[model samples]
Target: MKEFEEPTLSADAVLAGLSLAGRVRYAAVGLAGLTVALLVGALWATEPSLPLRTHVAFGGIVAAGLGWAGFAGWTLTRRVPLFARDRVIAGVLALTFSGATAVGLVLVAATRGGTTAVLTASATGLVLVTAALALLVTGRRRRAELLRRKAALTGR
Candidate 1:
């Protein structure tokens, strides 16, 4: 008997996946642009009349964070599988943001301006930071799960 072979799919059938992928990509691009715009606007809206030392410190923090972001991106791209990279990055970022927010809240409470009115915001910020921490934990779990699935798929 002749050996059986796999049937080939038609061109349209093979490549017709994700009809709205282009739209999704376009929307992602638009969203990314908007995020950048909002970030720049927030940075620009900083009070120019603030103390020179505060401005310098803010600049240093921004520079360091940007450098760290770049390094993280490089590490993710080189070391992470494409499918898991996003979750890994999101997890790492969420932890960092949550930790930073927690520190900020602590500092605010230690400062003289930590009145009850201002502390209301501290509660909200804390809640968000807690949620972010939860997200980070979930993302890490997802990454682990994905790794296990991949290993199983490869029979490793």
Candidate 2:
């Protein structure tokens, strides 16, 4: 008589099985979700004036976000020296850039005949961006701590 056993996989093993291309796909999907969110938010909160140019711009923004997400994920996984620093800077830049974009979108959406909508959208975008920036700083600090620990343990 012979007994057979099934193989078990560890979490690390499962994650390692995911190729870089797969990771990129996953990130793109996430970016797509965010794009949908932004589009929905725009439609929900502002007046309706959807145009072809606006849709195209939104698509571009989503593509950019997808690229950024893939790059960020790849860098995080590779864990190269100074990647954390770079991530933090990039994240801050992303927050500011996206925030500005959101403001512009909101303003255009709200534009009925005046700048009141623009001002309101700008304020909203500022708050959202500041929060995102704070999150980026926190992530950077965590990465810095991890790097310190690694250096100490390896005596590098």
Candidate 3:
């Protein structure tokens, strides 16, 4: 489909969206960089080598980075309202759920300390990683498609 510009979009509206989008974009970049840095830092600090157990946590960090970047980029390319006041609500909801899940996971690990619990945690982490990858891939595809449409329209 051809991309359509919003004729009613004001200068202020454009600025507002760019401002919000910029913030999210910067955040995503920062997160991804930090995750990579931390992984590298851990490796550097290790004397000989790190254990496989450590890689699991690193995987989670990488997943989080990818997910954050994907979502943020997706937010940036979308209509302004998607990243404006409404986005604050979405952010809060996301934070609440994520925080609760982390707490629950911790509690579960603490209360049920055993090989089974470890395995369960590992499984959960893998699931989260998979989900994040899904988000990353889909977001990239959607944004690319959007840009392709926009470019086609503008070029004509």
- Candidate 1 structure quality by residue, lDDT tens digits, 1-156: 999999975433443333356335534544554555456446746777766645554554454455445534454334224444454665666567556656656565556465774576577678878887778777778767766766666577
**Candidate 3 regions with alpha-carbon error over 4 angstroms:** 1-16, 20-52, 83-156
Candidate 3 lDDT over residue span 1-156, tens digit each: 999986885433543455656676657665675677567556645634655545554555555555555565555566653324334433443454355445456556766687777668766755655554555555556555655655564573
Clashes of each: 0, 0, 0
TM-score per prediction, in order, is 0.55, 0.51, 0.37
Candidate 1 Cα misplacement greater than 4 A, ranges:
1-4, 7-49, 52-80, 112-122
Candidate 2 on 1-156: residue-level lDDT in tens? 879988985333333334578557646655665666576556544745667666656655655565555555654465334424544765775686667677666757576535777777777777778887887888699767857766665578
Q: Best candidate per lDDT, number?
A: 2
The per-residue C-alpha lDDT of model 3 at residue 130 equals 57
Question: After aligning candidate 1 to the native by TM-score, how far in Å is the CA of 74 from where it should be?
Answer: 6.3
Model 1's number of clashes is 0
Note the residue pairs that clash in candidate 1. none
- Better candidate number, 2 or 3, judged by TM-score: 2
